[model samples]
Target: MRTDWLGAEFDGVKLRLWVDGALSQRIVAGSPEQVLQTMLADLPVTDRPLLRSGWPDAALTPVPSAVAVAADQGRMPGLSQAAPADLMRHQPGRIRGFLTTRPDFDGVLCLIGHSTVWAHLSAGEVVSFRSFISAELFSMIRSFDALPAPADPADDGFAQALNHAMSRPAGLAADLAGLRAQVTLGQSDKAQAASRLAGLLIGAELAAARPYWLGQEVVVIGDGQWDAHYLAALASQGLSAAQADGVEMARAGLQDLWQMMQAKG
Candidate 1:
């Protein structure tokens, strides 16, 4: 079927996904109707129904028909409105499990399906980043977008790290453990360790996206804490970085970071 976004403007972080809608639907088509309804039990309520979010009252756009078609992952045309007591926890395309912000921002964010502008923040800067293009991530529970989710925020920060770590090699895990230990000990080399960790994690996720990055054949390193500490760690090491080119950013590990950030579930 032809597809559309139901055009709505959400001004925040920007992330991207190339949904193979046909593939997704082919997979979902075989599931029983009750199972599909059960999985998407808590679809979020918004001013916009077509648009679902994990953030509170945030505007949302529904997953394009193409995605529903391709992923075959939702109730699609047969979805029913959720009752107040439904235990189901989200719409298929709804993003984020939590939506939060410091005291100053006007709108709250949802933190489910994908990464958003909020992620690029340094607990300080509110810059717009196109990568993982999202308006924000919220911890709002009881459904924010189409997905009905726990109002309690999900620990996405940790989820992204741990999820990626699980797929990588034991060697890389060992390396990260050692590095983190040194970091906890207040080692002077934490800056360098973090820098290297960043690259390794980036490498691992990117490699995973390749058709050949079989789970048994590859090793990944790093969790995203390094990025959280990036600027401070760089200063600690006395390194002045320059503007990151998109290609280099992807090559330098943003690509893998992208993969991890885009992870499902």
Candidate 2:
């Protein structure tokens, strides 16, 4: 089946296979269901073949995380819907995925992406979480016709602007205007202006998220690209963070859920 479009927008559809409850293989394609169905058609028919679906985090509201409160591990733990009503978007899949790998984790998880999420976890459950749109905001701002293209990776504008924003958040509007003026007046180059814009936005996010990260062990989960920026921002505040692979965490979480399901049956 054709699966080109899957790579066009994002990583193509992901498929995981299990035989007798043991993960066998994983596949990525533009159309995973179609591919899976084709493969299954050639297999010997079985009356009890189990077809489990991947968790769809986007379509569902995030439930406060839960873990087995007892030794059996497969036993269901009571969950509560305690997420604040204002947090419209999040990736609980990532949160669950990370926790499954490190069940004893106790701290704040900063999952950075288009809609970054900061979740507080304690005693093997998610205490609370808040989401921010800093990445999306950066994309939107960078797309303006008058703005410069994104800066080079080594640019110092990001650091300089971040510090400015962290110290003088109230001047954010003026800072933004200054960036445009700098770009328009030929004082700052394209890369410099772009980097500075990113710094300002990220600085604002760090400021708002201070309550989440202050005096807490932070583990940042993300694809490598955006992880560095958030890490740098945290480091500026004298905080150190550990990094984890976001994709792997999600896969592990799903695998854990699959094992739990098999145990119950």
Candidate 3:
């Protein structure tokens, strides 16, 4: 039987199709509803859709055979009606599990999305987690009349600010204030200020996540740009990390769960 999975992240939604134990196709859409609509449009009468809510707000309207991904320690109010009893709030754990399923895997795992950071130990335990107001900040910053556009990934301003934030996590608030001051006085461009603000926020997360990252091997999973920022930040601490595509990991996780269900049946 052909099985399709639809999942949502902070940035967008993704659909993965698996047929007879092989992945056959993948699609990306702007929103969960749009992705689901697309899936339904072409869905065969014999097929059912599986949904995994990555963020807090990713639940589709109830449909027959629609299953949700869940975590053991958390509740996804969005997926409450669609998820199976055996599947629970173990997303962070599942991501870690998928990473470890690879050969010779051992280390700390970091999942950095648009507005959240999840750090997990090699033992499949969550060490630290946080959800920031990144979208809110971006919206607020965009509303400014004179601020420069967001910084490019190649900007030294981003690296420098990220290093500074990691080193002085306690000064985050002060650093943010300084960013505004610099921008207001024309001492720094909008791009530089924006980079510094991001640095400050991520730096704080790195600080809190020190226990998981201090001496462990780390791997990052998420959007390429955000992953790069996190990799650079970790490198600033003299730490090295491997990178994995978040979409692939999400698909792998859903596949793993689906196989589990099939086995039980």
TM-score per candidate, chains pooled: 0.25, 0.72, 0.68
- TM-score top scorer: 2
Per-residue error at 166 for model 1, in Å?
15
Q: Give the candidate order by descending lDDT.
A: 2, 3, 1
For each candidate in the order shown, give its overall lDDT on alpha carbons: 0.26, 0.64, 0.55
Which portions of model 1 show Cα errors greater than 4 Å?
Answer: 1-50, 53-65, 68-168, 184-189, 212-265
Task: Please give the TM-score that candidate 2 achieves against the real structure.
Answer: 0.72
Question: Model 3, range 108-153, lDDT digits (tens) per residue?
Answer: 6676553544444333433333444453464465466355545664
- Candidate 2: residue 140 Cα off by (Å): 0.7
Q: Tens-digit lDDT track for model 1 on 132-225?
A: 2111221221023222221111223323433454356345557556655765686725334434444334334333322322221211111232
Clashing pairs in 3: 70-88, 70-89, 70-90, 71-88, 71-89, 71-90, 72-89
